[model samples]
Target chain A: MTSHPHPAPTEAGALPGSLLIRNLRKEYRAGQPVLKDISLAVEGRGITAIIGPSGTGKSTLIRCINRLVDPTSGEIWFGGSDLARLRGRSLRMARRRIGMVFQEYNLVERLSVIENVLCGRLGYVPAWRAFLRRFPDSDVERAFALLDAVGLGADFATRRADQLSGGQRQRVGIARAVMQDPALVLADEPTSSLDPKTSVEIMELMAALSAGGGTPIVINIHNVDLARRFAQRVIGMSRGEVVFDGPPDALEDRHLTDIYGGEGWLS
Target chain B: MSEAALSGPSRRWVRFTPVERGARALVYVLTAVAVIWSLRTIEIIPEFLYDAPEQTADLFVRMWPFDWAFYPKAVHAALIETLHTATLGTLLALVLAIPFSFLAARNFTRSGPLNWIAQFVFVSSRSVNSLIWALLFVAIFGPGPLAGTLAIAFRSIGFVGKLFGEALEEAQQGPIEALTAAGAPRSMILVKGYWPQVEPAFWSVALLRWDINIRESAVLGLVGAGGIGVALDAALNNLYWDQVGLILAVIFAVVIATEFVTSFIRSRIL
Candidate 1:
């Protein structure tokens, strides 16, 4: 059964949660590909920020891993299965292990904050249990703890999600993602709508919390400064292709200009 | 404070284009000519305006005050029956509409053929008038409260179903996406995500439909389906103007009472 050269069993790629994307492509409309043969790998730990200018396919690349935006052609290997080819039940199960946080903090407005946190458990809980809202005691306790960890007090449990400010909502968003105990996390422009201070605070919280459990997070970030600050590894994309992939220290002005294009804004 | 010095407009600017002026003149002339022609075609008699006041006065003289004695004999029971018919009918429609609406809502019901069938059912139910439905049901069930109840339910299905489908369609996609990413099954998505979003609309639509059903049921008895209209029809047939007046007054009171009650419920629930 062993066909390829062995890279020692202890190699990072042998780990169950390792994410490897190969030749991924997405064409929202025919003849106009948004993700063009992008390939990368993460060893399934720590934060890796994908930075690019607007409309440079950063969000699309993140979404494709979750199968939220279907990849036109490629292989997304994670958790011992090809994510791109999954359908229905298989797709949902895979998505469960890959948590996502949206830019807008898409909490169900009518739901209480605790319920929104419990939403991350829907994949594990039975349909009837979810409908009855009879979450397991452990999941409920975990959800409460997660709320506290995200800086919302346990008293905020019963409050409606819409009652929170932008920063608080993003905290809940992170809490919701981590509540899944996910193998990997994807955050699409997680701080684009946030103020400068709040943006850094969220990035810090995301890095600390996600790294605590050794869950790898792939965030689509527009702010290059925050990416440089929090990300251990950085990916720079331009015109649907990865132009730079290296550690944060190696990301130079030349790369920024190459990724973002002739930036007078860099001044 | 300087009213005399202020003016409406200056003559230097041309307002309406010549083409617009011609089009407006054509519209005005055509509308006036059409109204006059329609009056002639319908054989309108201006003389009725002269005699209308006397006829109305004489009719009022005949109707005079309420027929207090007749209220107990026929009006009260019929009014109660009308209320029962509407309540039961609206409940039945709601039960049927919930599943039917899921089928008709395009975003939920992905199959083209199934959606077509659901839409056809809604259209067919809505196309027929409640009175016509009453007439059909009366022919089948033999002129009773059952006919009136069935008539009201069948007629309301389209209205409630269409509104419900629209409400589901217009639900915020973001929460639903969140649920989907959480691995919620389709039914859980409906109960937790979609239902909460459309709950206010559902309540409002149901109450409004119930209010409409009440009015429809009252007059359904004209086609031999039992209601307040039956008592009024009988009195009219017998040339008893006072009893007819009494029944009309009861229907009016009942309608106004229900309007107040439904509006109160809507306010509280929504």
Candidate 2:
């Protein structure tokens, strides 16, 4: 598939979001913890890459923001509410402004590409209408535009997500997330399954999304080089704690050795 | 080539361990003993087998001389009754099973005691034969078409609920989670995420059971629960072999018709 590289999202006004996490903690077992007393704030605008070795707390931290994996103890302040304490309708409303992308693409395999993209509006639309596929004309048109903006042609709209290549599926995933008109986008290992070239393409697409709008992205990634190439700010984690936090240029071999604990893999 | 491979079939290279061989021998011996014991207990005799063909031939001879005229009114009404019993029973069972299956499905219910109760209902319904269910319903409801319809519905809950429950459990979890993250309501999750995935399977199970119910309900009249089987029972009691043959023929035709309709619908829709 050729890259069309259409223009950025311009229809929906960009409402950049701010997030502040205070003393976030998650313990799966009684004593052992996956994330420990971590605090970080993402102001707005630009991609914030979280690079760490496998089994670290990078994924946990990202998931906690959306309350997918509830934090053991913390305050998640986003859009004038504590995301940790919200329940039921309030939680859902808070989540509508926050969009998330997964490692697996996670599009409903049986649904067509257009329907999957329109799923982003499920929070706003009434249940009956959504179930009946009676999405408003404006929503449908915007979904098509989002698909087009992601370099997928109009023909791809009717195709099933499973029929596409890995790269194409990721494109749909991006389209779905942006379709939410989100303030914050959380991505968990979005490119770990793709080839090197496709990985770069995914990163480029995400970067353009962050740049065009003021939406901030916290991507948990393992590819350090890709993170450096794409991320404006990089936060490195080791043993469930952030060991280094700085701009990409400020990060060095010493910090890599500290975060990953290796000298041989750097060269 | 090795000597073993060249001398024998390739399968010779694979051998059962001594424990496996011993278990196999023990199983064979036990099965042989059990079969012999059961045959003796049931009083199997060579004399019955010798007379079987003769008796069948006598009955077959008596069933000749087509009673086609008897089927015009009496047999036709009974056949329609049987169809009604089956169709209404299936609709009732399908409606009842939808909620029970949710309780039984691991993903939907998630409650240990409720799941156990749902499983219990399914098992009990399935364990009783349709004839036995008709007998029970007749005792409670006083031997009418009402009894027959209720019997069919109760008997089918197990079949429909168990299949539909398994369908719910087999649905893909990824889309479910995606819907949850999008903050869709619980009902919406079911409507959009789960229903589409399981719609074809639900229809297939219901159609199969409807075809079977047609056959089962045709005989419920033996217990005076109503339907064409009542006509069948009356014929058999008076030793009216020709009338019996007519009823049997009508039942055979109806069953085949129902099978054709269900399969055609299944093929077209699914």
Candidate 3:
């Protein structure tokens, strides 16, 4: 497994820590914690894969950063502001800067692919424009470009989302994410629903997008090999806590055992 | 070993108490009595059976003998007015229901008190029948198509709002989550995620309501609210069965035709 090296530091106006989660804790019910005290800083660019066993809080942690599931206690410092305290318009403004891809494509199934891709601009575009399906020219161009980059051609734009295959839908999903011109991209088990070959392709597209656009990516993945293959840094999680955080080369069998527990499954 | 095991169970059965036996007998007796009672109560008596056939046959005979002459006048304007009233009412209802339905949806309105208020408004609007609403409107607006239109529109809001709200609730949570995560405002999320999913169901419901309103509008005219049913009612009162027959025939044909058209439209949409 090989990893992409981190991008060189740039002087452009970039958020210092694309995401800074400090002492994050979440509990769905009292005394039953989904995410324990977690502290991590995601770099400004490149993919950082979060690998964890099933039932671990990998999904919960990613969701918390986006505040899809609000944190019980924590400060998520993005750019210069703490997202946990933000509400209403302020929260939406922060969210607009972040893009998310999901395990399920999550495209509005009845909507055309172009419309689904254009949904990324819903935050920036006026409600009337969204309701009318009248996306601005620039957003359309960017969506088309992103679609082309993801290997979908012009004709697929008018097709209903449900008509597409899994890989095709995920490509649209990625396009929608990038359409946001997001500062940070969060993918939660994006490729888990795809076949191995398609998973690799999806991961490659995500990696390239992360590196090319210099968008910081925090991905929750179940496959260790895929994580090591694409990510610059691997954060191993078990029972809602980070067990190991280092470069993929430094991640060894012991760390895997510790993260997953027991030797029988490792083979 | 097998004989001894079986014998022990048989001996236990023999030890069964008189109370168990009495309970079993009671169950059988009660079931028998209940069955006999129901049969006696439900059995159609000779008098009812003899009375219904003659009445049904007389009605059929009286309705027949053909009403060809009245068809021309009935089809010329009355049918058209019914369709027009229905179309106006349904369209108006659809426009009014959209905002109210969004407010009424529990998922969208998280505040319990607000949801209760919305629900109260929706339930109250729907509680009154269209005919009753038409009567009330006629009292306010006077005898005209306007009252009929308002009545149909008001009644339709209850139905469309409740159904559309439910459809909105059942919309895929995935798109909503994605929109929220992307920081889209509540209004944006509704347009992008919620409306798209519910649009088809909304349209279908509206179309169905339109068809029903057409039928209702026909009857509203009998109450002085403008439609063909007034003429039909007068014809019936004057014992002009031939004209009544003609009006009934026109209504039946119109309804069937509208249903076919609506079904075709719904199929294309789906």
lDDT winner between candidates 2 and 3: 2
Q: Give candidate 2 misplaced runs (Cα > 4 Å).
A: A1-16, B1-24
The candidate maximizing TM-score is 1
User: What DockQ score does model 2 reach against the true complex?
Assistant: 0.48
Ranking by DockQ: 3, 1, 2
What does candidate 1's lDDT look like per residue over A66-133, in tens digits?
88789999888888777888899999889888888989988888899999999888888888888888
The C-alpha RMSD of each candidate to the native structure, in angstroms, is 4.7, 7.3, 6.5
Categorize the docking of model 2.
Answer: acceptable
TM-score of candidate 2 to 2 decimals:
0.88
**Candidate 2 per-residue C-alpha lDDT over A20-138 given as tens digits, one digit per residue, 9 for 90 to 100:** 77888999886788988898877667899999889988988988888888999877878766787788999888888888888888888878999989988888899888978999999
TM-scores of the candidates are 0.92, 0.88, 0.87
Q: Model 1: per-residue lDDT, tens digit, B1-270?
A: 576557645547678999999999999999999999988899757799789999888877767776889988888898999999999999999998889899988888899998888889899999999999999999999998999999999999999999999999898888888777766678878887898899899999999999999999989888899989899889889878888778888888889999999999998987
- lDDT string, candidate 3, B1-270, tens digits: 688786765443465589988998999999999999998899878897889989888766877865777767664476777778889999998888878788878888777887677677678779998889999999999987889889989988888888888888788899899888877888888878888889889988898888888888889888887788777877789987767777888788888988998899999986
